[model samples]
Target chain A: MKSILIAMLVAMTLPFGLATPACAGSGDVVVENAWSRASIGTSRPGAAYMDIRNAGDEDVTLTGLRTDLAGMPEFHLTSTNNQGVSSMSPVGEIAIAPGETVALAPGGMHAMLMQLRRPMEEGGTFPLTLLFSDGGEVTVEVPIRGIAARGPDD
Target chain B: MRRRSVLGYGAAAFGVIGMTLFAGWWRVDGPGAPQAVGARPLPLTEMEFSLTNHEDRTVGPETLIGSPTIAFFGFTYCPDVCPTTLADISDWLDALEGDAEKLNVVFITVDPERDTVEAMAEYVDYFHPAIRGWTGTERQIARAVEGFRATYEKVPTESGGYTMNHTASVFLFDAQGRFVSTIDYHEPREFAVPKIRRAMNDEEAEGA
Candidate 1:
């Protein structure tokens, strides 16, 4: 009876669009609007952007990420200097404060997916896993859009 | 009833917060500080430098000056900015309807070592058929870059590789080959398309 009540409570908090319970059982962090640009060729790397919102009271840190579509999926921060010279560097981890939202977008923060297994086609989807510092993981389905698309809404 | 009210309130809060965050993100990602078109034409009517086009043909200021030119400087290896800019320009030209043919779109390589004439030809074709890709000897490329006041340097990476750090602006020239304006690197179609139209209009008016 206790476990049944707990399960009911868990179901109440799990946000919408989270395809499965296996990916996000914590119900603390909500992922939405996950999308990436369609790849031009298989050799070139692709970028994915999304909004990660923390609904829980405690701070959450995204330590790493994984995806089957690419050989490596790593977090990166692109910095452009005053001279319009742009460079991208690896970022250790991203921390989201309670009730705060972190946006990974083009020309800013992005999840660089390198060595794509195949060309990312428009309207196709892939599975992604967000590993948190606390050992929890949230899986999401990212939709592929056109190269110029700014976000899922676009 | 109480649960519904709480959920509604939470959604409202999210709507307000999400909008604020989106606005902030757009400001940072969009073109930050683009140079506007100057009222007076630059003294150098034509930028002079000997370079080879994708067709292995010699090209200089005289060849590029017959039409209003749209030019950018970058390398083929550039993952984000270069491809994004080229794709944006292609979209802008497509939006121009038939007027796209009236302009000359050029891509000059900052890394001459890797971007050969044949490589340039292949790269520009991925974007548009009319887009011309240019590259030459290091000294020749330096002269062209200097003429435009653009800067490029080689940055060594930890993996025993290197990447070219270059100016990310698109330059516009009049039909007479005089410098007219510059669009910020990676400006969206909504922002860059109108500026291109304005340049074409000026070029037509000058011809009249």
Candidate 2:
């Protein structure tokens, strides 16, 4: 009965077009808008964007990502300098403070899905596991949007 | 009366010299000039480059000029900014109504080793139908970037694969090959469309 109630609470918290993977069951980290753009071709890498929130009293660190979608999945930050030149660099672990939400969106930090296994098509979905520093992981189904998708809601 | 005729002849000679100098200046930088008609020559437009378009045609600065053009530097492997900007460009063209056809939109690849003409063709197909893809040799791409004041650097990722860091801004040029302003990355559509229109108006604004 308690498990069923927790399921109900999870369903109530997540709305249509928003994805939150088992925060109630796994831990206090809630992920929403897990999505990626449709790749142009199989040779090119892809990227995923999402929002990870830490609802627990303690800080949570995102250590890594694992998925079958790409051979190498890493964290990348795309920064623009003052002269309007832009560049991307591999980022280290991301720490989410208590009640803080970390966003991986376009024009900023994102989950770099490198060396894609295949071309990610629009309307398709893939599973991704987010590894946390506490040895806990949450797997979310990432939906593929158009090549120009801004977010899950877009 | 003889002195009066001499003074008249001297005045006519001075007028002829002044006219010749004025005509030279006008032909060089005036409204009737054949190139960059009414405005200063845009350095980017003058920058020479020989590249192959997606359709396998030899294209240089002249092809891109003679019409309002927007050239964006990016690679097909780019997942976020390039696609987003292309989609934004498509939206701006849509907002342009029929006038969008009057403008030339080119997507130039900074990483030509991977982004071949075939790759560029398939890549630009995702966005507006009018977006033309251009790719060339590394030296050609370097030559092209020099004119726009654009820069690109290849950085190897930990995975041994490489990615490029390039200028994220879109360059805008008038029909006469005069440099206008640039549309920054992620510029709002409301602001972007107006800038495109401003470029479109350049020809008539200067009576060129």
Candidate 2: docking tier: acceptable
Residue pairs whose backbone atoms clash in candidate 1: none
Candidate 2, residue A95: the lDDT equals 88
What TM-score does structure 1 among the candidates reach?
0.72
Per-residue alpha-carbon lDDT of model 1 for B170-207, expressed as tens digits? 88887877787878777778989888877777778898
i-RMSD of all predictions: 4.2, 4.8
Candidate 2, residues A1-154, lDDT tens digits: the string is: 4533654465455443244344432277677768888987677889898878776667778889999989898888998776566889888898889878899988898999988888899999998898887777878888999886656855
How would you encode candidate 1's per-residue C-alpha lDDT over A51-129 as one tens digit per residue?
7877666778899899989887888776666666667777898888878878887667788877789988888999989
Which candidate gets the maximum DockQ versus the true structure? 2
Cα deviation of A143 in candidate 1 (Å)? 3.6
Worst 10 residues of 1 chain B by lDDT: B34-43
Q: Model 1, DockQ value?
A: 0.14
